[model samples]
Target chain A: QKEVEQDPGPLSVPEGAIVSLNCTYSNSAFQYFMWYRQYSRKGPELLMYTYSSGNKEDGRFTAQVDKSSKYISLFIRDSQPSDSATYLCAMRGNSGTYKYIFGTGTRLKVLA
Target chain B: EPEVTQTPSHQVTQMGQEVILRCVPISNHLYFYWYRQILGQKVEFLVSFYNNEISEKSEIFDDQFSVERPDGSNFTLKIRSTKLEDSAMYFCASREVGTGANEQYFGPGTRLTVT
Candidate 1:
């Protein structure tokens, strides 16, 4: 099984709607969970990061990690057209080697 | 506000040619990594370097692939012989520490197209 698995969603929603992006992993050793945003033809940009389990909120974005279930999620409240982009979930173990495993990104489109 | 920077934003080369993608990581960062993303595919890890040596590498980082931090500030990924399947967006990333708490900063990326 892949270390990380995410739905390759082209999820479309109207402006002001809430968006939820999620990923699951098979490795319980993963301690660092990250969400990245990528635009077409550009590199992925780090958006949110969390360590271990629990919820982290930054502005309109919230990242939640459920280590027990091996699940992670990024929630975007009041989504906007500018928020349209691909979302990638990445994870790494606590080995201190800084090696990361990434999931296939989910493409999102927020329509105005 | 420091960030990683990559050169030759885009490159096109014929199969069997050698290609070198360059990067300048954050000055104070201690760890470096190379990753690649094929069109519409997941971003795959290639290799990680520390103390001028490879600390770890993924299966994708085969014999044909090499990474070097020849100078203090510059890091590079070189493919000995490019193949058509080698075309992808390559990203360079760096972190101030190797711990899990340290966040990695990524470069804009170098898009390589092998014909």
Candidate 2:
């Protein structure tokens, strides 16, 4: 099984809607979870990062991690058309190697 | 805010040709990484560099692939012989020390097209 799995969604939502993105992993060793947004042909931009199981809020984005279930989520409040991008979830263990395991990104489109 | 930067926004090379992708990581960051994404696949980790040496590398980072930190500010990924499957977008990322070390900042990718 893949270390991390995410829905590759072309999830379309109207502007000002709330958006939720999620990822699941099989590796319990993963201690750091991150969410990134990518535009077409661009790099993955860090959106939210959580050290372990808990919720972190920053601006319009909130990140949640559930280590027991090996699940992580990113919620976008008041999503805008500018938020249209592919959301990628990445995670790494505290092994000190610092290599990240990434999931196939979910494509999001917030229409105005 | 400082950010990572990569050279040659796009590169086209023939199969069997050699290609070198370069990056300049955040000045104060101590760790560097290389990751690649195929046309529609997930971002795959290639290698990580710290203290001027390789810390870890994935299976996809085979013998044909090598990474170097030739200077204090430059990091590079070299593919000795490009393969058709090597066509992808390559990204460079860096992380700072101390607080929030796990937070890596990524640069705009270099799209490699191997024909």
Candidate 3:
């Protein structure tokens, strides 16, 4: 199985709607999970990061990790057209190595 | 706010030619990384550097790929012999130690086209 898996969603939502992006992983050793936003042809911009399990909130974005399930999620509240971009889920182990495994990003389009 | 920066945003080269992609990471960052994304694919880790040495590298980072911190401010990735399959967007990222170490700041990226 792929180490990390994410739905390659071209998920469209209306402005002011809630958007949820998720990823699943098979590596139980992964301890740090991150969410990045990438515009077309641009690099991945760090949005949210969380260590271990539980929830972390920053402004309109929230990140949740369920270690037992090996699932991670990024929730965007009051989504805007500015949030239209690809969302990438990345994670690394606590083994002192900085190598990150990434999932196929989900494309999001927020209509105005 | 300081950010990572890369030069030659777009490069086109013939197969078998060598090409070096350059990046200037955030000045205070201690860790540097190189990653590549093929069109419509996930970003794949190439290598990570710290203290002027490679700390870790993925399997995809083979004999043809090399990374260097040639100077205090500049880090570079060199593909010794480019192949058509090498065409992709390469991103440079850096992370600082201590607080917020998990956050990696990425550069805009260099699009390499091998023909």
TM-score of each candidate structure, all chains considered together: 0.97, 0.97, 0.98
Number of the predicted model whose lDDT against the real structure is largest: 3
Candidate 3: regions farther than 4 A off: none
lDDT by residue (A1-112, candidate 3, tens digit) is: 9999999989999999999999999999999999999999999999988999999999999999999999999999999999999999999987664678999999999999
Estimate, for each residue in A1-112, the C-alpha lDDT of model 2 and write its tens digit.
9889999989999999999999999999899999999999998999888998999999999999999999999999999999999999999998776788999999999999
Task: Say what the interface RMSD of candidate 1 is.
Answer: 0.8
TM-score of chain B of each: 0.96, 0.97, 0.97
Give per-residue CA lDDT, model 3, range B1-115, as digits (tens).
9999998899999999999999999999989999999999999999999988999988989999999998899999999999999999999999997754778889999999999
lDDT of 1 by residue, B1-115 (tens): 8889999999999999999999999999989999999998999999999988999998889999999988889999999999999999999999887344468888999999999
Q: Model 1: chain B TM-score vs. truth?
A: 0.96
Candidate 1: C-alpha RMSD to true structure equals 1.1
DockQ of each: 0.83, 0.92, 0.85
Docking class of 3: high
Off by over 4 Å in 2: none
TM-score of chain A of 1: 0.98
Clashes of each: 0, 0, 0
